[model samples]
Target: MFGKILIANRGEIVCRVIRTARKLGVRTVAVYSDADVRALHVEMADEAVHIGPSPVGESYLRGDRIIAAALATSAQAIHPGYGFLSENPDFVDQVTAAGLVFIGPSAASIRAMGLKDAAKRLMEKAGVPVVPGYHGEAQEIVLLASKAREVGYPVLIKARAGGGGKGMRRVDHPDDFSEALSGARREAKAAFGDDRVLVEKYVDKPRHIEVQVFGDNFGNAVHLYERDCSAQRRHQKVIEEVPAPGMTPALRKAMTEAAVKAAKAINYSGAGTIEFIADASGGLKPDRFWFMEMNTRLQVEHPVTEMVTGVDLVEWQLRVASGEKLPKTQGEIALAGHAFEARIYAEDAAKGFLPATGMLHHLQFPDAPPQGAAMRIETGVRAGDAISPFYDPMIAKLVVHAKDRTTALGALHDALARTEVAGSTVNMAFLAALAADADFAAGDVDTGLIGRHQDALVAVAAPSDEAIAAAALAATDAGAPGRAADPWSSLAGYAHFHTLARRTRLRFGEENILARVSARPDGRFQVALEAPHDAINSHDLRNLLRTARWPGHVTVFEGAVGYTFAVPDPLAKADEAAAATGSLRAPMPGLVKLVRAAAGDAVIKGQPLLILEAMKMEHTIAAPHDGVIAEIATEGAQVSDGTVLVRFEDGQG
Candidate 1:
């Protein structure tokens, strides 16, 4: 094994690599950008180096800077963890040219699988089944449209160089093909710097199943089973599981063989994943699956595979990169228990899963599962860390293992419920709801599961009366003189011979609650619910309050959800003027990528008005109703959250 290695990445994956390197007694170096000076991964590394500014182009994407940092730190090899430079073929060549071992596949392997169109063609020649699509190089709009028609309606236009759902679109009709192609090309160019695309037939009821494959420079390769990544949102996997539900032994064998074949065909080295889009319409079958793409590095959901196979994939990567033979043959690896990994992200699940930025005031995960239960939480951010907009908003990956799929899923639900977070919008509630979903529990999942059940999954419930009372009590300072020095003075009611009583008003979302409290003889206060008119002990309410106050807001976690309440200031004006006439505000902070409607242009309801790109995703703002656009935000403008982007006439004229 190498004595020291440089992790050429950031966030959880960097920390993940550091953990394994430490176990192997390998010294590790971490590279960071301007925005990550205080990042968790930096603190965990044996040595740290500053690369460049926060913008990826100037920092993480700069292969030269990363190589210099590794050479300066005397790192024997460089581990490109997952994103950033992990899949960049040119970076691999650069690292090799620098005389440092790249702890991953060779440049040839990456190039062989980098472009989707070319990779598909390669797979077909290698006798691996590939989706029926036009992988040709013709980029003319008319030709592409004709190909889509040939492939039948509902064709998928995917950027040849795209991943993470970027630069991809689904067109269900011929009329929408032109627009979809243009948008896909633009996004592809912006994201991958490649405008080339491929048209593919969209499978009905598609299920994403990918096999974990590993290879050594000695020409040996093996498969570590498969992961079902069908639970997706916006074409990105949200939850991944090993030993796919309803998977038959025969089918598993065939898929694994095909995956191993694909890896060997490329002379693949280290860890890689061969993703397949299986036709679930007729259930999983050996002949019903087609190659999608190969992730040429360790995957974000590798933990589940590790849990089921009882292998440390990173350790294997290190061993293989050190010129060791394959750790185990295909027959040596055996599937153990079922496992599930839920990606916890710092985003508002109810608001289109919009990426959020804030300081993490409080964070906690469920305690380790019982001695025999396998549970893991992988994260790079702590309670006080900030979720910046410069990187992916992923908070952590929650993994659990059990005897069977049902039991493992049950464990997943409990784990999500026990997870706690505050000071930022999160998808915890949505995850919990998903775990409890009957269809999900029964293993009836696909890429469209989230969209099919979005209403229930994203629905936000109002805080209960008890929850509101708890928030109110938490917001009130425990050190206040009224409550600490004289409990009676804090009461909400008082009479000649009765306890004093006080009513406190609190707001949760758009609903307000009046909590009546009175001092009791036992030093505890009694709370009365207004709507339900139920009397409850204040001690009970206080016990349920898990809160943290920051500046002008208090966040309380209750019923597996975190609710933030703003402490109203009496000095502030209540009736602030509404937004200036017909103004449409930007929903979040982002760069105005495109202005679709010009000033004085008439638009109908739901018409695309402008596109705002934030956190590496594009969001289109649409007209609320029929109206003439009076003004529009300039293209390429940087707008803050809630900044008016456009104004419309009072009525169409």
Candidate 2:
């Protein structure tokens, strides 16, 4: 085994690689950009190297800087974890020319699968089943439109070099094909610097099923069963599971063999995934599955496969890169039980799942299942860390396993319900709701599951009366420094000769609530809700506040939800409210990518006025209503949240 390896990545994947390297007694080196100077992975590695600035192009994507860092640290190998330079074929060649091992497939294999159109052609030539589509090299718009018509309406316009749903669009008719193609090409160029695209027939009720395949230097390869990544949003996976819930023995056998064959076709080495899109309109069938694409590196959801097969994928990567033979033959590998992985992202599900950034003042997870229990959390952030806009907003991956799918899914729900996060908005509530979703629990999932049930899934439930009272009590307790020692000193509106009820006013969102508190003779406090419909009686405040912290603001986690409440100062409410009107504000800090309208341009409601790119995703700022634009921010300008992007004329509607 190599004595040391450099992890050319950041976030959880970097930490993940380091963990396995440490377990094998291999020293690990980590490379970081300016934004990740204090990142968790940097703190965990045996050695760290500074590459460049915060922007990925200046740092993470700088293959030269990464190679130099590895050479300086004497790293015998470099592990490109999942993203950044992981699948870049040129980067792989650079690493190999530097006389260091690249702990993944060869550059040739990556090139074979890098472009979607070319990869599909290769798969077809290799006798691997492929979807019916246009995989030709022609790029003319008219030719592409004709191909879409040939494939029938509802064709998919996809960037040949895209992943993560960045440059993909589904056109339902010929009327929309031109616009869809233009948008897909633009996004593809912006994201991957490649404007080439392919048109494919859209599969109805599709299920995303991928097989984890590994190969070694000796031409030996094996499959690690499969993961069902059908639950997706915006074409990106949300939840994944191993030993697909409805998979049959015959179907699993056929798909696994096909995946292994695809791997062998490329003479693939190290860890890679062969993703297949199954036509689920008639349920999973041997002949209904077709090759989608092959990811030429470790996958984000590999843990689900690991949990079911009891194999260390990263360890296999290291061993294979070291020229070792396959760890185990295909016959020796076995699937034990069911496992599920839910990607926890720092995003607001209600707000179109836009990525969010903030300090993590509080973060907690349920205790891992006792020793052998099938539960694990893979994360790179801790309390006090910040989720910046410079990188992916993933918070963590929650994996759970059990003897059966039902049991494992139940555990998933319980785990999500027990997780807590504060100091920023998160999709925890949405995740919990999804775990408990009847259709999801029943395993009737597809790419459109979230969209079909979006209203309920993204609905933010108002905090209960008990929860509000708990927050009030916690807030008052936080304001009193001597409450722990002298309970009476914490009392508000208390008299020397007479007893009176004390009320605390608090603001949660836009509603203000009055909480009445009284000191009981038994030394317990009773909190009553006085607004938003009064509670009939007071409830004892003993354990309602599971965890409370006051750092500039009050945050309390009660009943599996974290609520941040601000005390009304009666001083700045008017100013704050007045500053938030008659303008389009940037929802989050980001770079202005495009300003669609000039000052004084007349626009209709919902008209696209500008585009803001943040966290690597484009968001359109639309005109709130029919109005004349009075002012607009310039394109290419960096703006903070609440910075006015456009202001409308008064009564313009």
Candidate 3:
């Protein structure tokens, strides 16, 4: 094995590679940009090198800088952890040209499988079932429309060079084809620098099943069963599992064989994944699966596969890259217990799952597992780390394993419920809802499940009265003079005969919750809430008063309410404002990639006026009302949160 290798990536994946390399006694060198000087991966590596500025184009995407860092560090090989330069064929060639081993597939193999159109054609020739689509080079808009009509409506237009769901559009009718094509082309060009696209028939119920394939220099290859990645949002996978639910033995065998064939046909080596779009309209069958695309590097959800198969894929990658044959043959490999991976991202589910950026004030995963069993929490960020706008906003990969799929799902649900995060919005509640969904429980899922039940999926969980009281109690500052010096001064904890009453309101959704608290002679308190629906909930806060987080916004315990007291200084209250009347803008840092309207330009309500590219995705800024653009702020520039992109004139005819 190589003594030292450079990890040409960042974030959790870089941290992931470093962990494996450390176990194998291989030294790791981490490359970071300006924004990542204090990143977790940098701290985790044996050595670190500063590459360039904050923007990816200025650093991570610069192959020359990465190669120089590796050579300077005397690294023997470079592991292009998935994303950035992972699938870039030219970068692979450059690494090998420098006489350094590239710890992934060869340039030839990446070229063969990088482009969707070309890879689909290759899969078809290799007898691996491929979806019926037009993989032609015809760029004529009219011709593309005709092909969509030929294939039928509800077709998928995918960028030939795209991954991670960018540059993909689903056309439901001929009229929408032109707009989708234009949007897909623009996004593809921006994301992959490849505007070429391929049209494919959209499966009614698509279940993303991908086979994990490994190959060696000795021309031997094997499949590590499959992972069901059907739980997705915005075409991005949210949850994945190994030993797909409802998978038959016969079907698994066929997929494994086909996956091996696909690997050998391309002379594919190292760790890769052959993603198949399975037709779920009919139950999973050997014949209903078709090749979608192949990921030419280690996948983000590889942990689930590792957990179930008892195989460390990273170890295999190191071994194979060192010219060793795979340890096991196809017949030798065996399936084991089920495993699941839920991708915890720093995103706002209520805001359309838009990637969010914030300093992690408090981040805690369950330290004590139920029954004291092992659980895996793979993350690269620590408390006080900021989720930068330069890369993916994924917080961590939470993986769980059990004897059966049902048990695994149950464990995952419990884990999510116990997970706690503060200081920023996240999708934890949404993930919990997904775990509890009946369809997911029954192993029935599709790409559109999230879109179907979005309202219920992203709903903020209701905190019981007891829970609220607990939160209030947790929020109470024990150090306060009023609470410490006089227990009766604290609401719901009066030691005197006549109890004091206190009122507090909390924000839930767009509404405020009015709650009244009454102190008891004992340490406990009673909370009464009057809601808009004329509903009243009287909660007991005995346990909450004794055990609650210190100075919290709110807390829920069982079905009861808890209230903590933090009597803010009147001086501080005078200095705080409830609302701002200034213009609203992007909430996080980002680059202003597009300016849709000029100053004095008339715009209607909800009209798109600008686009900000942050966290590897584009977000549009819309007009608040029908008005002329009064001011356009900082076009084509990097901006922090609340940096206005466009301002509207006051109401006037």
Error of 2 at 196 (Å): 1.2
Q: For model 2, how does the per-residue alpha-carbon lDDT over 323-429 read when each residue is reduced to its tens digit? A: 89988999899999889999988887888888888998888888766233479899999988999888888989999998888888878877876788887788888
Which stretches in model 1 have alpha-carbon errors above 4 Å? 370-372, 478-504, 514-516, 528-535, 539-545, 571-581, 649-653
TM-score for model 2?
0.95
- Candidate 2 residues lying further than 4 Å off, grouped into runs, are 370-372, 478-493, 499-503, 535-545, 558-560, 569-580, 651-653
Model 1, C-alpha of 543: deviation from truth (Å): 6.8
Instruction: Point out the worst 10-residue segment of candidate 2 by lDDT.
Output: 533-542
Cα-based TM-score, every candidate: 0.94, 0.95, 0.89
* Superposed Cα deviation of residue 395, candidate 1 (Å): 0.6
Candidate 2: residue 159 lDDT (0-100): 91
Q: Which window of 10 residues has the lowest lDDT sum in candidate 1?
A: 476-485
* Candidate number of the best lDDT: 1
- The digit string of per-residue lDDT tens for model 3 on 333-425 reads 788788889988888887788887877766667775533233688898987888877778888888888888888887887677666665556
Q: Compared with the true structure, what per-residue lDDT tens digits does model 1 show for residues 379-462?
A: 999999988877898999999999888788878877776788888889988888888888888888888899999999988677
> What's model 1's TM-score?
0.94
Question: Number of backbone collisions per candidate, in order?
Answer: 7, 0, 24
Candidate 3 wrongly placed segments (more than 4 Å): 370-374, 478-521, 525-539, 542-584, 595-606, 623-629, 632-637, 651-653
> What is each predicted model's overall lDDT from 0 to 1?
0.86, 0.85, 0.80
